[model samples]
Target: MTQKKRIVIKIGSSSLTSLHGEISRRKLKRIAEEVVELKEEGHEVLLVSSGAVAAGYRKLGCVERPTALTEKQAAASIGQGLLMEAYSEYFLSHGYVASQILITRTDFSEEKRYKNARNTLKILLDRGIIPIVNENDTVTIDRLKFGDNDTLSAKVAGLVDADQLIILSDIDGLYDSDPRKNPNAELVRDVKEITPEIEASAGDPGSAAGTGGMKSKIEAFKITMASGIHAFLGKAGVRGLLLDAANGTASGTYFTPAEKTLDSRKQWIAFNSGPEGTVTVDQNAKNVLTAHTGELQAEHVISVSGRFKNGAVVRLKDENEEEIGLGIINYSSEQLQHFRELDEEAKAIVDSEGLVCRIDVPLPATI
Candidate 1:
């Protein structure tokens, strides 16, 4: 028997929407059936699905997807319920329970809330329930939005520590060039690392119903791979695609990082926490920080930029202003500056547990 695995599958709007830009029951049912099969095979499944705005725009009397933030939010408010009803009904028919989980960027930004969300998902998955996740688009402001479900799915996979992240899209797989513009473009089967050449090959969104393109998917892969999770990108609606993906036999682009992977706390510090200030350290301090030999000392701080409170995330920079890592500041920027001027005795400015170096993966952009 195949080993049981925890899997997170993300289906984009384009895959679930009909040509009329509305949710397709046929597509939803097909996906539900596949998920049921996976569950029956003794694997845990979590779904991150997109299509709320597309599913409700017509009900809002719009001819096309709404561009205005308020309009989109209104559409999502209406569509999210409808989308959940469909999923719940379909899964119920297959003797499985489906639960909805609406998330905002703020949920992950706050450490307490992030841990709570992870704990909740763990309970649901352990009880054999499929957790259906999506951005809380109805209430999320532009600044707090996840932008697309592609990245949200990757983050969710990392949050749940899934064995695999399967992203089903309109395209078959990653290509060496834009397949639409270049008919002879070749599909890349396996990728151990994302190179500049691979990033250059990604293209824009292929469908009006979808927000994420190949570029966003590549970024998502970087997150998952760095988290030590294997991922697959392939065409939606392919026969037994989910099973094939779990079994490592799927015909799609596969991303597998090198041996090392970040721990949960490091993943949070690297991807979710928003830096509130910059902390510049001299070369000696930089060496100690990078070596993970000791905690940062106030005496090592060259300068502190921006205002932030204690326990807030801060960017650690070298004297040359190059970003080296991120850490939770033990003192506020003002306090650190005061200590620098006073030339006081050495004091710990950042504990070792709160620091995450950028040597593993690029730090997430600040909110």
Candidate 2:
């Protein structure tokens, strides 16, 4: 019997839209069928779908994709409902219920909301319902946008502790060079790390209907790898591709990290909770934090930057101005500043449990 695992599947806009740039029912049907198969085989699946603006713009009377933010948001407002309707109809026909989740960058940035999302998704998966996630594009401003669903999928995968993340795009896999520019470029089969060479080879977005390109996909993989979730990237609409990916037999670029997986709190601090401020520590404090010897005391801090509330994620920097790591500050920036004037015995600050180090690793761009 195959082991039951929670999987997060990301479908790109190019995959869901037709040549004329509208939501294709045939494509949606195929995806629904594949997900049904996975459910029958005893795996939990959550989908991150991108095509809101692509599916809705033409219906909004635009000949091409809207360039203005409000126009695009208007299109998304119309399309999101239609998209969910199609998914719900298709999944229900196969005896599975589909649920919609509209997410924002702020949802993940706040600790309580982040955990709430996880719990909700967990409940859906546990009850055998498929959760379809999309960015809350209609209400989100440009600054608060997730940028693309690729990054959103990775964050969602990490949020639910998914066993695998399958990203289906127009391209089959990562190439050694930009295939459009170089005909001799070869597909990379397995990636242990997102090295500089790999980053250099990734090109811009390939489709007019899609916002995320290979570069964004690579960024997504960085988050998955760091979270220790295996990820696969391949062409959409391939026969049995979803099942093949779950079984580790898919023809695509596979990403697996060499390091141990991060815990849930660490995953949040590393990828989601946006650091509210910076705190520079002395050499002794840095040494203690890095070595896991003790907590960061107020007397050990040289300076604090930015205003932040207590329990906010803050960047920890060293005396030389290099970032050491991030930690949940036990005191507000104002409190820390006041405590600087207090004696050492009265200045206990961030607890060790709230601290996370290993700042040298390449974190996801969304962080």
Candidate 3:
């Protein structure tokens, strides 16, 4: 790493588990050592790891991984402390401090709390402390869950405006076809854009211990790419993997960011602060917003669905009920239903100057 960079590494449960599907100390030590080396080289590192369930299930006196939600949560409660203890011990031996941050979706949904998390992480990173992040599975409900840690890692990468995100898995890289099914599957070493074919080829979790598979990784890349953060997906436990990925020479699939990126404010609006409702607009407004060169006006809004207060993020849809993008609406659902035209005095908005309706964030392209 020639220039100092902020990097986030996501390690899945499969990478940290043994053949019997339990936490492996050797794998954890290897990851911690590489991270310490990265820190010594003047680079900031944040880890988003998933192994609580794997580490705690056996301790819960189970023969294998538990499928029930309550059982999973119980396992996490037992494993989180053990996982952190190991991480702290390894990092402390290397003369470094490791802090733990366990968060749920609500932390990112509320703007105030989101900014606070960002600020806290910024302070830790500045002080040369590596913040290890994980989803607070003990109390998280399915409705507010992030689905998988892969999604959590991508969101965190955007939260800190990381320069790059490295996702470590058991697979070496993405293949055109399922390697297990097809004997001659070709590894896709570089990817500039995620095409429809690529999305279609993404399959379910390959390992019994993992929750998110190739599909989840692809979805995670969409968030990073939209935020203008480069990302790499590669096999874990490879020697010098972190350094090589940062230097752009790793044996993995690299994802290039979009030319136009969303800033911190926009990223929060787009990826976090989950939409409260949908605002339907005319075809013309939808076209302009997705094209990256347009502003939304109250006159263009045809209708509003769902109850949302003013200053809330809402999904922007078209006449046909197709989602175009998302933005912070100035008027509440009740207010928009009452009147169509927003006068200048009310400050409907102008290119997000008065903060009325800002909808420049683009969604992923569909086939």
Candidate 4:
């Protein structure tokens, strides 16, 4: 028997809820059935579901999306409970357990916290429970907001190192023209790359109920693909679409993974977290690092900025301020400045040759 593939399936608001803003029980049951089948097939699955605000819209007597942030927050708070309850009851009948995990952008931005989350989810997967993730809209601040579930789904894929991510939307797949307006629009089955031209073809958000338009989905695709993970977009209401897509069926638009494997730490450094500061290096230094995979040395650095301390990860930039890489600083900014003042030969003596330089190591006074 083949090993089961790990997958992440994200269902947007438009598909999971009705236009009048209620959870579509029929749709939910069909999705639940497919997911249970996948689980029985030995596949590990994670769900990124949207519809909290939509489910709450009717409950608040609002006919549309709330304009006020507080209203939206209240709706989400109310709807999240209903959404999870429906999920739990449905999955329970199928003999499968479901767990709800609400996350903010900040959760994936802190390395230690990101690792903790990864471990927690791994334990759930080990126990044969499906982890259903969502954005914590009720308490998450502006900066922590994921903006939409598309980005949240991508981040979940990266964190779990999922083999594929399936984003089920209203449309069947991407098109050269807006299918609603253009009768001759061609359906693009395979999208190995998301160029700017293809993005221009995606006109706008289909509905006001959803936060992210096609543009946001494209951005999410870029994130998932960079981590060497496959991303697919398909029709949410289609039965067995998630399973078919995961099995490499021609059901939707497929974004192929990159050739190189993006390691877990590199994934965190590149996209998971925000950098504390930046280190500027010359062209020679850039060439050595980018082309030859060289280790950083004090002689190659031009300057360091921001309030980054020793052992903190910082972004590396060239003279033009273009990001080149990220790495841990061997010295603090003040210590780096002292090293910069010395000549190349003198600096080599201190940094490379281990000469007795009067440097203030922050820990303790040792003769």
TM-score per candidate, in order? Answer: 0.93, 0.93, 0.92, 0.89
C-alpha lDDT (0 to 100) for residue 56 of candidate 2 = 96
In order, candidate lDDTs are 0.86, 0.87, 0.88, 0.80
Where model 2 places Cα greater than 4 Å from the true spot, the runs are 342-367
Tens digits of per-residue lDDT for model 3, 1-367: 2888999999999888888777789999999989988898889999999999889889998898999989999999988988999999999999999999999999999999999999999999999999999999899988989999999999999999899999999899999998989999999998888888999999998888979999999999988988899999999999999988988888989999988788899889888888899888898887778876757766677888899999999888889877787778887888777656556555344324433476746554310
Model 1: per-residue Cα lDDT over 72-136, one tens digit each = 99999988998999999999998899999999999998999999999999999999999999999
Better of 3 and 4 by lDDT: 3
Q: Considering only N, C-alpha and C atoms within 3 Å, which residue pairs clash in candidate 4? A: none
Q: Compared with the true structure, what per-residue lDDT tens digits does model 4 show for residues 1-367? A: 5458889999888888876778898888888888988898899999999999888867877877887888888899989999999999999998889999988877888888999999999899888999999999888867668778988898899899898899989889988878999999988999887777887987678966677778888888877877888989998888788778877784779988756546787677666666677778888777766764456677777887987677666777789887676666667777777888998789887667432111111111000
Residue-level error in angstroms, candidate 1, position 274: 1.4
**Model 3 regions lying over 4 Å from their true place:** 284-295, 340-356, 363-367
Clashes of 4: 0
lDDT score, candidate 4, position 48: 93
RMSD of 1: 3.1
Candidate 3 worst ten-residue window by lDDT: 347-356
TM-score of candidate 2 relative to the true fold: 0.93
After best superposition, candidate 3 residue 75: deviation in angstroms?
0.5
